[model samples]
Target: MRIFSTILDTVTQRLMSEPVRHDPAALSRIRRAMIDLMPKDANWEDERLRHRLLVAVDPTSLWFLRVELHQRLGRSVGEEVALESVQALWPLFEDSIEPALLGKRPGRRSNNQRGDTPPGR
Candidate 1:
């Protein structure tokens, strides 16, 4: 049993470290699933949208969304784009997941945060 456990652990670690390659068909299917699951004309400001995304969407689908977005945008898969893509794909999730996952919005600058550019400059 101990040997079996060790083997399982080793396999799991290797799989986790490996990068996932998503084919075009797989990406298409994932996008379809996302669209199907999305609630149309529903109030996005409600917390239920965030909860649904967290619970309904599987981890694999989410990962593929990020990868597809990064590749399509021709940007390196960094933490910022990885997250921004998700929000862009699902506006219902905007301002909700980012604050919780990243502690703030990416690429959004407040007027005060912007360097002094003179009033109405």
Candidate 2:
């Protein structure tokens, strides 16, 4: 029974350790979704991001691009909309990134958290 359990664990680890293979079409869809969030009158930064997305060959590249996307969207559309749209992309990256990392939203802090206090208060 112990040998059987060990073999099962080894098999499970092997399967889990294998790298996730992303489909080209799926990458394209994610890219398109991000690009759709861009403003109609895209600035140089937006153009650069668009180019990066076009040339990106893996899920990690697209994953990091979410930061730039959130910033651009926040500035152009407002934080609420930006947060929603960026969060929406998390599901699409499920197979690519660790689930634990996806749950934490950047810049999210409670009012009592450090640095949240305004100056001159």
Candidate 3:
């Protein structure tokens, strides 16, 4: 599992290192799909932010993310994407997408998502 994730992360990083001018709608759809596919206990904030940064800040990762999002969009619209359209993306999502998320850690919910404030803050 870790090996798979490492490969995916490396690929994602490499892809994120090019120029992408993707549509906002596609991104929105991707966000929605990701939300649905993700486990509720997954680290949504970090992974979501990372994906967004890949699209906005990193040009390399853009097309792959867009294509992945597009495939999910196609499914929603009852369209079918060709296999070659994005064969490499799903594995990465399965493996590398949430490397830091293994399950809800202690206090994660209370400290991060809940309204409760941390002691330092």
Which model scores highest in TM-score?
A: 2
| Residue 80 in candidate 2, Cα distance off native in Å | 1.4
* Candidate 2 lDDT, 1-121, residue by residue in tens: 9999999999999988976687877787888888887788878988998899888887778888888888888998899788778877766776665544544346664342332122222
Candidate 2 C-alpha RMSD relative to the actual structure:
9.6
Q: TM-score of the candidate numbered 1?
A: 0.24
Superposed by TM-score, candidate 1 places the C-alpha of residue 40 at a distance from the truth, in angstroms, of 2.0
Sorted by TM-score (best first), the order is 2, 3, 1
Cand. 2 Cα-lDDT: 0.75
Root-mean-square deviation per candidate: 14.7, 9.6, 18.3
How well does candidate 3 match the true structure in TM-score terms?
A: 0.25
Candidate 3 lDDT tens digits, 1-121: 9999999999999989874454555544444544454333435454664456444532234434544544454554434432323332343333223323323255555335321111222
Clashing pairs in 1: none
Off-target runs (Cα >4 Å) in candidate 3 are 1-20, 43-121
Off by over 4 Å in 2: 1-20, 100-121
Q: Which stretches of candidate 1 lie over 4 Å from their true place?
A: 1-18, 45-121
lDDT of 2 at 23: 80
